[model samples]
Target: MNMREKTTKAENTPADKVEIAVRLDSELLEQIQHLTNDPSKVIEVAIRQWLRGEILRDDELTRTPVRTPVPPRGEWND
Candidate 1:
């Protein structure tokens, strides 16, 4: 392996990543960085779960005809 490959930061990055920028308060930002090695992955999982719940809730409503709220994360579908 060449030195360039060893030094590259994109080694584990997905090929299709959407660039986004957020401004975080200093304390919360530091807490996340210090507590989690991969904050991006944590955020990604959270978003995916939220989207999944929405989709599931929509399908459920169509079949049941009741205005029930979607179960919180890690509840109905884990």
Candidate 2:
């Protein structure tokens, strides 16, 4: 309806959001920005890594291994 509302909305709107909050130290935040050139990009990269790890972990859990259990030594009937 007004310029102020439009400006506020534009600034507040996130491209995508997860309803969560995370806190980081100022030094850490600065470090991430320095390393990635964008703080948000660092967060995005971290989220991607975390998701990938979950996928790998799930895959390992669901994969079937072909291995027979070994019994005690010298227990075979001649």
Candidate 3:
């Protein structure tokens, strides 16, 4: 079918050691399980990809600085 269909079908199989929750039609799940044989891996990979995107999307990482404010000139004569 389409890429999504292919991916979905390929994401339900069992791999090494990992657990993930996915909601889909039974038929779709079965199809995916048959193809991927590791649902957890599929979900893990997807989540990691999404998180990476989000991390990169937040461009404020380098723009914000945390430091104590400098006292006003009038108060700092010492």
Which candidate gets the maximum TM-score versus the true structure?
2
Residue 36 of candidate 3: its Cα lDDT? 95
Weakest ten-residue segment in model 3 by summed lDDT: 8-17
Ranking by TM-score: 2, 1, 3
Model 3: per-residue Cα lDDT over 1-78, one tens digit each: 776666543266456444445577888778768869866666667678898874355567667778999998888877
Count of backbone clashes for each model?
0, 0, 6
Per-model TM values vs. the true structure: 0.40, 0.43, 0.33
Q: Give lDDT tens digits, candidate 1, residues 10-48.
A: 555577886566776888777887868877776678688
**Please, what's the RMSD in Å of model 1?**
14.7
Please tell me which model should have the higher TM-score, number 1 or number 2: 2
Q: For model 3, what is the error of residue 1's alpha carbon versus the real structure, in angstroms, after optimal superposition?
A: 47
lDDT of 2: 0.72
Report the Cα lDDT for candidate 3: 0.66
lDDT, candidate 1, equals 0.71
Worst 10 residues of 1 by lDDT: 53-62
Backbone clashes, candidate 1: 0
Q: What would the per-residue lDDT of candidate 2 be over residues 1-78, giving only the tens digit for each residue?
A: 876556643366576754445699999998887797657667877788898874356767888998998778887664
- Candidate 1's displacement at residue 16, Å, is 1.7
